[model samples]
Target: MIQNSKLFIAAAATLVAAVVLNPTPEQHRARIKEAIAERSPLAGFLGVGALTAFASTYHPLGLASYTTVNDHTVSIGVLGMVFVLQPSKDT
Candidate 1:
């Protein structure tokens, strides 16, 4: 558990550093997509699908909060999955 926590912290720090370096929009998108792809494609798909489903369930007024929360969850899942899967450089 301690090792896992340290690993998570390290990964989060690396991601933060990468973003702070102000990568181009395309680079950001590609990095994020690559991370997501590193995880099981199905997992990434499901994460986004779940967020969309949640957003769809709510009315417009209620949707903002739902979308915000769901988006954060999905993003974290994608990032974590990417870190865990550790895709190859070519990927």
Candidate 2:
């Protein structure tokens, strides 16, 4: 679990660095699309992770915390879906 967290941090850092380097507009769009695709699974994993972490911290109410995390995750996922489907400026 610790290892997974480290990996997620590394991946996010790399992504931030790549974006900060500032590719061309087309490259940026492509990168965004690729990133959204690649990180989709991570997003779900993060939701689960958050739930687990919450469980560890709060103890007794873990199930309810997990459900809340899941709900938030779904909302975020839906928002991302909307973002991905929106027409690009280049289009």
Which structure among the candidates has the greatest TM-score?
Answer: 1
Clashing pairs in 2: none
Writing each residue's lDDT as its tens digit, candidate 2 over 1-91 gives 9999999999987666544543332332333344444557674445643343243221112112111122222111211121113224653
lDDT of each: 0.39, 0.36
- Model 1 segments beyond 4 Å from truth? 1-21, 43-91
The TM-score, computed over Cα atoms with residue i paired to residue i, of candidate 1 is 0.27
Across residues 1-91, which tens digit of lDDT does each residue of candidate 1 receive? 9999999999988767544543232333344445554555885666753333334321122112111233232222222121112324653
Q: CA lDDT of 14 in candidate 2?
A: 69
Per-model TM-score, in order, reads 0.27, 0.26
| C-alpha RMSD of candidate 2 | 18.0
